[model samples]
Each structure stands twice: as structure tokens, then as C-alpha cells.
Target: MTGLIMNERDIVVPGEKIASGMDYLPGNGTFREGEDIYSSQLGLVGVNGRFVKVIPLTGKYTPREGDIVVGKVVDVGFGMWNVDIGSAYSAILNMRETSEFIDRGADLSHYYDFNDVVIAQVTKVVRYKDVNLTMKGQGLRKVKGGKIIDVTPSKVPRIIGKQGSMIKMIKEGTGCNIVVGQNGKVWIKGERIEDEVKATEVILKIEQESHTQGLTDTIKNILEGKGK
Candidate 1:
């Protein structure tokens, strides 16, 4: 007989058995050994129709093309800036990709100085060390006067919520301009520091308790209690 050994949203460790028999199929973070399916990573269980997968609880950021990421300029070279996007490899932002006619031999640092934070889109991912980024798109620009926070990259979807409802609610409640990058970096700017702090707290709470049920209601209650 086919059966699920673990319920949906169940926390599972690596190599833990999550299902039994041939009627079930293994998805991401899972492996099939004979008739049993086991978890390949420590994460929350996700059951979608007949597919079972694990939503990782923690992991390093994996840059993908077309991902919007919040990155810091680490080094300014002849024609490009090296950005640390919370990944093992630093992404490159070429001056040509800045969407301006940059004259050759001009100081590239004038456009993007070192230590500057920017919201950029991943233009290309040739390899780990060759990730390319661009700032030509709308809403992609330098971040100023805000606090940045990091979360597990995998938990970004939960923070964004369906149709951007979760983030919209948080912004309404805290009066903060929040930007969430796919690289797990979040920037929050508010009129008051207390509002920013509250937004940060709520975001961290969602990241920690994402696997739990009734998360929407719980977050709403938290915001309401703060008179937000």
C-alpha cells in the first residue's frame, strides 16, 4: 500500500523516511530507495497532489538569471564592480550594463562607489564566479538611508506572499518602504526607526515560523496589536 509517513509541513531531517510504496513519487529534496522515499535535506514537507518535496529551512543563496537581488559593491575595477550578493561568489556589474553612455577612461567609481548598496537584476549566470548583474530595469537603483536584513533565500516566497499581499500588508502597517530581493536581502526605510524595527521583527518572525499553519492570521494579529 502507498502512504505518507509524514504529514504536510512536517519538519524532516536528511535521510528521514517520508513516504512508502510505489504509488508516491519523490520530488525536490527527496530520494527513492526501493519502495520508500526519504528526505535528502532538512526541511519542511510539501505535498502537492502526488508529488512530495521538501522546502529547505536554510541554505546559502544560489544566484539565478532574472533574479532581483540586493547587493553591496565590494570592489570597483576598471569597467565593473564586484558585488557580494550573500553568495559564495561575487556578482559583476559592468559599467556598460548601467544603461548610460559611460565614456571610456572615465572613473567608474563615480557611478557606483565601493560599499554602495543597490537593487540589481541578475542579467546572466554563466557560472558561479561569472554571475552578471544590471541596473537598467525599473525599480533597480541605489539603496539609501535604510536598514538591510538577510533571510534564508528559500523563504522569500513566504515573505512576499500571494499576489504581494503579505509585503503590502507589512508596508501599510509599518509605513515603511520595504524591498525584498530574491537573494534574501531586505531593505526597509521608514519615517521613524521604530517602524523599521517593527517591520524587521515581523519579517524575521515570518521567516522563522513559515512552516507553521495560520501564518497569515498570526502576522495580522501581531501587526494589529502594535496599532498598525
Candidate 2:
């Protein structure tokens, strides 16, 4: 008989057992255990049919199409902006994807000066792995008066929780507007600078501890303490 050692979303650290037995199958990050199997490392458990794989919950940013990300305007060209999306591959935001009626000869600097932060959407992913971004729709623009924090891209889903529940709780408790970039950059704005700082600290703490059980409850406790 084979048995699964862990369930989906269960965090396992290095040398942790994942599964056992031969009749039953194993998923990712699993190895045959002389008719049994086990897992290795700190990651979330994901089971697909007879296969079980461990999805690492903490890692660097990986580009994906249609991911809304926060980026800095690094260089402006005749009709495009080079954005640093915290990856080896930089992204391009063409003028056509910007605001309409952009003056043909307007100084791009006036629109997006170097080092300016902006919210953008990944429009296309090239064969070379380069990302194309755009900022021409609602809720996409230069961010002002906020501090940015970096977190593991893989931990974003946990921070957001199911259907935006986790983040909403944080915002309601801290009275801060939090924007999580798919590329792992988080922008937080609050009524006061201290509030913003506290919010960032809370978010970072959540990110660091998301692999643990009862994360939502833990975050709630933190928020409640902050609220008081």
C-alpha cells in the first residue's frame, strides 16, 4: 500500500517525507522509496492525479503574459519606454500602448521620467523571453507617494489569498491601499508615512511566513493588533 504524506498547500522543508508505497503514485518532488516515495525541500504540495509534485513557494520572479506588474522607467526612446521588471529581461512599453494623442515629438521624459514607478500589464511574451508591457487602461499609471517592497513572486498568491481575501483584510485593518505587482513589487499607500511603513512590514512578514499553516488567521491577528 502507498500513502501520500502530505496534502496540497502543505509546506515541507528539506528532507521531509512526501509519500510512501508502490500501489499509489507520487507527484512532483517525489522519489521512489524502494516501493515507496518521499518528498524533499520546503515547498507546497501539489497533486495531479497519480503524480505528486512540490511547488516551491518561495522563488525569484518569472515572467508571464498578462501579469500586471510594477516597474521603473529606465530609458525612454522615440516611441517606447524601457522598463525594469526585476528580471534579466527588460520589458518594452510602446507609445501606442500609452495614453492616446501622445505628441509625436513630445519629450518622453515629461511623460515618464527615469526612475518613475508605473503599473503596467504584460501584453506579450516574445520567443526570446522578453516581455512587452503596456499602460493605457484604467488603474495603470505612474505611482506617486508610496513606498515599494519586494517579495517572492511565488508567495504572491498566498499574500493575496483566495479571491483577494487576505489583502483586503490587510487593507481594512491598516487603512492602506496595497498594490501587489505580479513581478513581486508591492506598493503601499496610507494616510500617514508610519502607516505605510507598518503595512509594508506586515506584508513582508506575511510573505516570509506564508508557508506555515493558518496563515490567514495569523495575518488577521497581526492586523487586529495594528488596528488597536
Candidate 3:
């Protein structure tokens, strides 16, 4: 008979037995050996039908093609801007990927000077290092007049919640324009600075307690209580 050795959302480390029997299959961050499934890394256990997986609790962001990310312009070079996307490998945004056309040697820094934060999409990633970014799409551009915060990349989904319900609630409660990046950067802008700070606290709370059950209801209560 198949049996779960750990509860769903349980914190597990590598080599921890998660399930027993052939009825279970291993998914991401898990491995199967001798008819048993084991956690392959430190993460929260998630079970769906017969498949068991572990969602990482902490990790660096790995840029993937088609991911929307927030980046800081670190340097301006010939026809390209080097961006730090909170990853080991910096990304390149060529002038062609920008929203406007450029003339040769036309002062690239005029477009994206150092330390400017922008929301862009990853267009290509070669060998996990050569990442290319684009800023020609909707909602992609330099973000100004907002506070940017970083969280553990693994908790991004929990911060967003299902169908963006969590983020939507936060935005409504604080009356802030918040943008969450796949690279774990969150930008919050509000008419009042207090609102921005509150939104930041809520997002950090979600990141901290993401593995807990009843998280949605809990977060909703938090927002409502704070609004009063």
C-alpha cells in the first residue's frame, strides 16, 4: 500500500523519505529509489494525486526565456545595457530590444543610466548565462518613484497567490501599484508612504509564512485588520 511519510507542506531536507510504495511518483526536488520517494533538497512537500514534489524554500533566481523580471542597470556599454537581475549572471539589454530606436553612439546612458530599475522580459537565455532582455512590451519600462524590495525567489508564487488573488487584495487594501518580478524584486508605489510600507510588510509576511495552511484567509484578515 502507498503511504505518505510526511504531511503535505512539511519542511523536508535532502534524503528524507517522503512516501513509500510504487504507487507514488517523484516530481521536482524529489527522487524515487526502491519504490519509495524521497526529498532531494530542502523544501516544502507537495502532493498531487500520486505525484509527490518539493517546492524549494530558498534559492537563487535562474533566468529563463519568457520570464518577466526586474533588473537594475549596472553599466552602459556599446549598444547594450548590463543589468543585474539578482542572479549570478548579469543580463544584457541590447538597444534593439528597447521601445525606441537609437542612433549609433547616441549616449546609451541617456536611455538607461546606472542604477535605474526596469521591468523587462527575458527574450533569450543561452547556457543559463547569456541572458537577453527586452523592454518593448506593455508594462515593461523604467520604474520610478517606488520602493523596491527583494525576497527569496522560491516564495514568489505564494506572494502572487492563485490567479493573483493575494496581490490583488494587497493592492486594494493599500492602494498601491505593486509589481512583482519573477526575479524576486517587488516594487511598491502608493500615494502615501505608509501604504507602501504596509504593502511591503504584507508581501514579506507572505514570503515568510508561505508554507502554512489557510494562508489566503490569514493574509486577508491581516489586510482587513490593518485597514481598520
Every candidate's lDDT: 0.92, 0.82, 0.92
- Give a tens-digit lDDT track for model 1, residues 88-108: 899999989996789999998
Per-residue lDDT of 214 in model 1: 90
* Tens-place lDDT digits, model 2, residues 102-122: 878888888888999999999
Q: Which stretches of candidate 3 lie above 4 Å from their native place?
A: 1-10, 15-40, 45-53
TM-scores of all predicted structures: 0.84, 0.79, 0.84
lDDT of 1: 0.92
Taking all chains together, the TM-score of candidate 1 against the true structure is 0.84
Native-referenced Cα lDDT, model 2: 0.82
Off by over 4 Å in 2: 1-45, 50-54
lDDT of 2 at 207: 83
Which residue pairs in model 2 clash with each other?
13-41, 18-39, 26-52, 27-51, 27-52, 27-53, 28-52, 28-53, 33-36
CA-RMSD of model 3: 3.0
Give one digit per residue, the lDDT tens place, for model 3 in 67-104.
99999999999999999999889999999999999998
